[model samples]
Target: MKRLFKSFLVCIFLVSISINFNPPSLAEPTSPYIRYWLICGPFKDADLNTECIKNEANLSPVAGQKVDGKRWRRFLSCEDKLTFEKDEVFGPYGNSVAYAYCEIYTPTARKVKLYLGSEDGLKVWLNGKNIFTNNAVRSFCFDEDKIDVQLKSGWNRLLIKVSNITKEWCLSARFIRRGDADIKDLTYRPAMLYQLPVKKVEVSSVQPTEPKNKGMYDALNAIDKDRSTRWSSEFSDPQWIILDLGKPKSVKKILLNWEAYAKNYTIEFSNDKKNWTPVYSTDIGDGGQDVINFRRPARVRYIKVTGTKRGMRFGYSLWEVQAFSLEDK
Candidate 1:
């Protein structure tokens, strides 16, 4: 009896260790659907296409926390159907917007199919990048939309925005395993009020060739934050500009506002500025506001924009070159 009791205690200890330390791994692919969410809303005006509905989309929320001066709380759905009604969660008012935040954990990095359904309109962001959106008045059904998402190893943040146009306000999401290759080790957890590490960055200087007009079209104009100003290069096929971000930063996104755009270009990053690594390359380029989001953040101090083919007869003229990190940089 003593030996049996000792063995039982040993098994209990092992289970506790696995539950605490090995939280990411699972014995089998259990009920891997998200059922709990940290939600808050009823900010009036429920237009999914409008910016008003996405005001709190980028927030890192916790249970019982206040967002935009409104209280946020954790809500659990007993059934597969999820609701974000004005009176149910945070509303007694209609024609408003609500947000739901959740986290997913994967043992390995892989692409997975996300099946989503929603009523009215919806927008979704995974790891700070907008992945899916639909602006339509409709009823909710299972798998109304399917999105292919590449989730990195460990935890991935998911933010959902649902808008109500005086009717049903709800959304549902789940992961559909892709045959046998589907990840068996997957875990879904409630997002309570956790914050991810935010990367930092500082600009040191910008290096570009003498502009067509030195003072009027200077290299510094690109970073001046004024859309009216522009940095124009000499009329040439191959033009390049390098920006030193002071210190190494985890770069995740890049935005370029082009006046005279490049038809072919590559956005590269480096530490020593000698060896360059291309994060983005384009052969068929469109002249406009170009926004690039990297699946994985790159740690670098130097960024270079090399253009080979000009969209216009003039050289590459940029109104702004903005680099963004995970958080504020």
Candidate 2:
């Protein structure tokens, strides 16, 4: 019929060029998990205008976009300044408490200053003294400079520094140590409106018999005695277990079993005792019981369970270790 109608219009022009050049996998919608603090370059000094004036004058942005979120900006270049050596320590609210409320983002706007130091204890300032000191005693000192500061055009100078370093507690703080085209961004929300509800103690079964050291007896025989642990089988290596929430509590939901095996694991969160942060992670590998939901709720005393990947072993076994506060609602 005329070459079959030109072969059906060349198969409709090759199906409209394959539907406009292959476009069909679009399902990327996941945005819910914000937590930030630390609004300044915690410094020991390599001098980049004192780490760009503590990362552009203590910029604050607890969440994201909103009159520049929290505010502060003025330090452009030298690669923004982010260095840690003398033992390394960075926690501007990534963990470690002292006072909360975070969110900052200063794309532009200058005039900033704030500095703090510690090795034993710290207390800082900027608008209250440009610089205020506390017991500081680990040795790199810089406290005493509260000048005529004013930054406002899109997030100005708002300083605050606190430190506590005794032995291996190296503390460092910086802001507007210098300035130019500043860039300070931070936005974290979900402290549960400043959460404060954790007083429900009663998890004592006195069980501690399973340590033959096959990595602590496969993590104490994969949880029992009310500490809970499971995988059901399908694990090759990489296993971990550590819990000591005997004090500070205020967690939410973290129940996993992933027995059957598919692969995926990463859950780290710590307090004092050392310092670790991963929050919650999973691949769900089609195993089994897996629930990890938290959008800003954690007070932790200590928790660690590692397993980067070892699936195909079918050795997943963890039963019960439930924890919930805030009236367990």
Candidate 3:
């Protein structure tokens, strides 16, 4: 009877532990894998480099829109590998092509890396510009290609054209930081609230003499899209630099990444390179990054910055200079 009672207490103890115990889970690392997309496909495409492929691959997709009788539909991919053949939108196709489109919104302009994989052949377009293409016949693998891309400050468009010669068809793509870290400030949307027609203005000329160090700290380094290099002036007050935008562009904001900053500076705009108008000025300046926004947009071809007081013992130096203009999309 004592043994039977002890067995009953043991059963009760086991049941109590089962009811109260919580198992530990080894959580998966955070990943920014794109799961939502708009897919349209089964187009007849044999050669990936032909004009027929180019015409179809460059297409901009809209949800519920029809292209060659195939309506664009929403696809939710639960797996990181987007297996189109296994999905309802596509099933067991051979020697054909398809397209996937997605939009990513960023709050700021930054450079990011794209990890992509495709079965058979693939082509990619970003913001109406063809960014990547491969005609190699291969199976789908995770992160087969790593492409560097610059994301604009607002909504950016990403389009993928995938081809399958035989068997299965699949693709995988995601955006990550330069060090392969997950991006947290991205929002996936099918449509943009509004679009900004922003393009890079070509730098026509730079003035205020060449750097004494030449290639090390040249005048062109400030706009070379490389933050590791910088343009530095001589160690003197009243140092200045001028940049010609080749043509008049509607400007609203300017970003200055400073290396050796200025305590007092004035930014001026000019149309003919001779006459200048002050757009922004500051007396108390801090180093690091400075984003200057104008009260109203200005149309100018020339931008000049003059520094009257140095923040440190060194001269005025800039790691990067960027200007932004927004127009109707």
Candidate 4:
């Protein structure tokens, strides 16, 4: 009995050490978070300071922390960006040496392009390793700095230092480009804020009202997980494609990959295959990959995209149709 007790104690001790020291990583893929936990200091060039830039633990974020002296919090630039005068809008920043750090949480390890815009000399670091540096004096433009970065599959650190001796002092950043271009295709939310798991859902059936060419382009091609194949509807006034997501699902987002034909369209959902409910609609849709976000979650099994206008004289064509559900994490 004494020997058995000693072995049990050793096993418990080993398990505790592993659990405390070896933190398991989240295997599921997650979007990059763009919200930032910011801390700034005013210094001068030629005599730069590296205290804040060296330690990342001081900058790591905690939920519901009040913003005050030495600690500030702000969300990244969404569709609109700030000019020189808007520097104070982001935080308590002034015309001098300032350092900004934005930490993003990703679920998968991959490479992404970090869109950043700033003035004067700037230095950047990712996960304690330097990735980008622009040593020049220039004006801040939208997407001024495009740096490719490899993000880990969990909590990642991003830090930036700027030396502004001329012009305005500001920064505009996004995971991708901003403005209407973003509206057309912005399905993934930045990983900075908390979000529920959302991905492409599987459909049980896909059908079109009228295919352009007889039996050539089927509606299933649009949902077959292939990009090259597409679904083309016959040349007519009203054409649409519908998908049944197996059973009733909680859907909150939709994507339209048009082939220069869909200039106007509407997204409708229904449960009993009748009494349809229109969730989102648009009149001017540029021919490209576009994303539509539903402010309210719709529970339905049937999802349809009805096109009213065409960019050209051709029929309404679609490269792909996607649906997703985003809930509180």
Mind sharing the TM-score for model 4? 0.38
In order, candidate lDDTs are: 0.71, 0.41, 0.75, 0.58
Give candidate 2's whole-model lDDT.
0.41
Candidate closer to the true structure by lDDT (higher is better), 1 or 3: 3
How close to the true structure is residue 278 of candidate 2, measured as C-alpha lDDT?
73
Rank ordering of all candidates by lDDT, starting from the highest: 3, 1, 4, 2
All candidates: TM-score: 0.46, 0.25, 0.51, 0.38
Clashing pairs in 4: 32-191, 33-191, 33-192, 184-290, 184-291, 212-234
In candidate 4, position 62 carries an lDDT of 38
How displaced is residue 100 in candidate 4, in Å?
A: 2.3
In model 3, residue pairs whose N, Cα or C atoms come closer than 3 Å (at least 3 residues apart or on different chains), thus clashing, are none
- C-alpha RMSD between model 3 and the true structure: 21.8
TM-score order of candidates, best first? Answer: 3, 1, 4, 2
lDDT of 1 by residue, 134-224 (tens): 9877888877888888999998888888878776778788876665233457776562222122122222223354566446777777777
User: Residue-wise lDDT of candidate 4 within 84-133, one digit each (tens)?
Assistant: 33433333334455656666656667666778777766777777787777
The candidate with the higher TM-score, 2 or 4, is 4
Residue by residue across 108-130, what tens digits does model 2's lDDT show? 55555544343444444332333
Where is model 2 more than 4 Å wrong at Cα? Answer: 1-105, 110-217, 220-242, 249-283, 286-295, 300-310, 317-329
- Between the candidate structures 1 and 4, which one is better when assessed by TM-score? 1
Instruction: Write candidate 3's Cα lDDT for 1-329 as tens digits.
Output: 99999999999999999999864311223346776678877776555554433365456667678765777876655457778787355886888888888889999999999999989788888987889999879978889999999999998989888888888889899999999898988987552221112223322223355567446767778878889998887788888877676766656578889999998998888888787777678999998999886534555677788888999998788898887654211
Stretch of 10 with least lDDT, candidate 1: 22-31
RMSD for each model, in Å, please?
Answer: 19.0, 18.4, 21.8, 21.7
